[model samples]
Target: MAHDASGGEIVAAAGTTGGKKAGFFARIVIFIRQVIAELRKVVTPTRKELLKFTAVVLGFVVIMMALVYGLDYLFSWVTTVVFGVPS
Candidate 1:
């Protein structure tokens, strides 16, 4: 019952028995519409907040990488010391 800018008849409620099934174009339109609706509800962060979040995430990633690297090096050294060259 709905129509688009191109005057193409848009199908509605494909889930219903009498309703028409949506085609590929119709599905795309529906998906875009839903995305727009969701975006409208989103509360965007301010520039300062965005920068803070980015810095925090980057710091956490760096800390985790360092921790993993330290653990790996410690384990490798311990293994080498315990089991020397098997000649």
Candidate 2:
């Protein structure tokens, strides 16, 4: 049993705890099977959906950049006022 960062209990899968270690090749096979299973679960977005998601992400990034720049400018101005401007 393992505790995650959030303190949730994580139980080990059956037959995996204190079992005889699988050989290197057997481990590789199991990894490949898990990879295939995960790949099958992936959903590819349609072209329109992809474009919309991209635009939204770009817009959000731009907005955040503007916000950070404004905050930095405000802090700089405040600092200049608190202390004499650099010569």
Candidate 3:
């Protein structure tokens, strides 16, 4: 067992592969185990944190939409003034 730079344990696989490649099913099992191990480390946000994040995202999106709409309106007005309102 060794420790990596990030302070995490560097785990070596138990048993030897005898210099032979793992079969397809063996590889799949290894991948699924790794996936499960990673999933176990995931942290879920609390309800308050989730709501705050959602509000922040929605507010940012609304601000961007308003900025785009204002720019579009300004461009349209300028175009109309320059082109004499398309007759």
Measured by lDDT, the strongest candidate is: 1
lDDT of 2 by residue, 1-87 (tens): 454444433344657856556567866766676666667779999999999999999999999999999999999999999996889
> What tens digits encode model 3's per-residue C-alpha lDDT throughout 1-87?
444444444345657444555577866766676666677779999999999999999999999999999999999999888887654
Q: What is the lDDT of residue 23 in candidate 1?
A: 74
Show how many residue pairs clash in every candidate, following the order shown. 0, 0, 0
TM-score of each: 0.63, 0.74, 0.66
Which portions of model 1 miss their true places by more than 4 Å? 1-18, 85-87
CA lDDT of every candidate: 0.79, 0.75, 0.74
Per-prediction CA RMSD (Å):
5.5, 8.1, 5.9
| 4 Cα displacement, candidate 3 (Å) | 10
State the local distance difference test value for candidate 1.
Answer: 0.79
Give the clashing residue pairs of candidate 3, or none: none
Indicate the TM-score of model 2: 0.74
